[model samples]
Target: MEGIKRIYLLIGQKGSGKSFIGTLMEKEFGIKFIRVEDWAKKIKKDRNVDSEAYLKQVFEENENEIRDSLTDMDKIVFESTGLTEHFDIMLESLRRDFKES
Candidate 1:
């Protein structure tokens, strides 16, 4: 339906090719892929070795702030390693915060 919004969240460990799967979905289904890690990097730049991990943690911790970066889009796909300490917290927060609003 036009009013329906579908968001596919892909979760896995580091180097687990979650993005590869997302890419395939994008290519096959024309679904737009949005990687949370990329948004995290845009919000806070890190040059350290574990920057990816740090950005993910920051994103999950500040779900509200990151959510602001999101726009109204349907059939969206998000892939993450779920290595952040607050991965579940972020998901729960997003569910509660972004419900048909």
Candidate 2:
């Protein structure tokens, strides 16, 4: 695993124990666990909307914030679903930007 960046992503239905397993990784390996839903929840609270609409709106509106929050992080696990593809695109964009710079 030398020089390889390792990331563990757990995708599943809500209330299906994703956070429970994430907590295990946190305790056992000191991997930081970030619940993607928490961000949406925060945004929802900020917007004062209790609807599920905040789920997608959170990403659409705050993707940069989400991406920036992860800057320089290490040994982390992200529990996510819908945002995975968007995150991957962001990562690739960052890689290309770094190479060009």
lDDT tens digits, residues 1-101, model 1? 34555667888887789888888998999877767666666656545636666655566645543454355555667787776556676777778755643
All candidates' lDDT scores? 0.67, 0.60
Whole-model alpha-carbon lDDT for candidate 2 = 0.60
- Winning candidate number (TM-score): 1
Which segments of model 2 are wrong by more than 4 Å?
1-3, 46-53, 60-73, 83-101
Per-candidate TM equals 0.63, 0.57
What TM-score would candidate 1 get against the native? 0.63
Q: Candidate 1 lDDT (Cα, whole model)? A: 0.67
lDDT, residue 41, model 1: 64
**Residue-wise lDDT of candidate 2 within 1-101, one digit each (tens)?**
43334456677778888999999998998877767777767766556544446544655544454345456544456675534555565446545533322
Question: Model 1: runs farther than 4 Å from truth?
Answer: 43-71, 97-101
Best by lDDT: 1
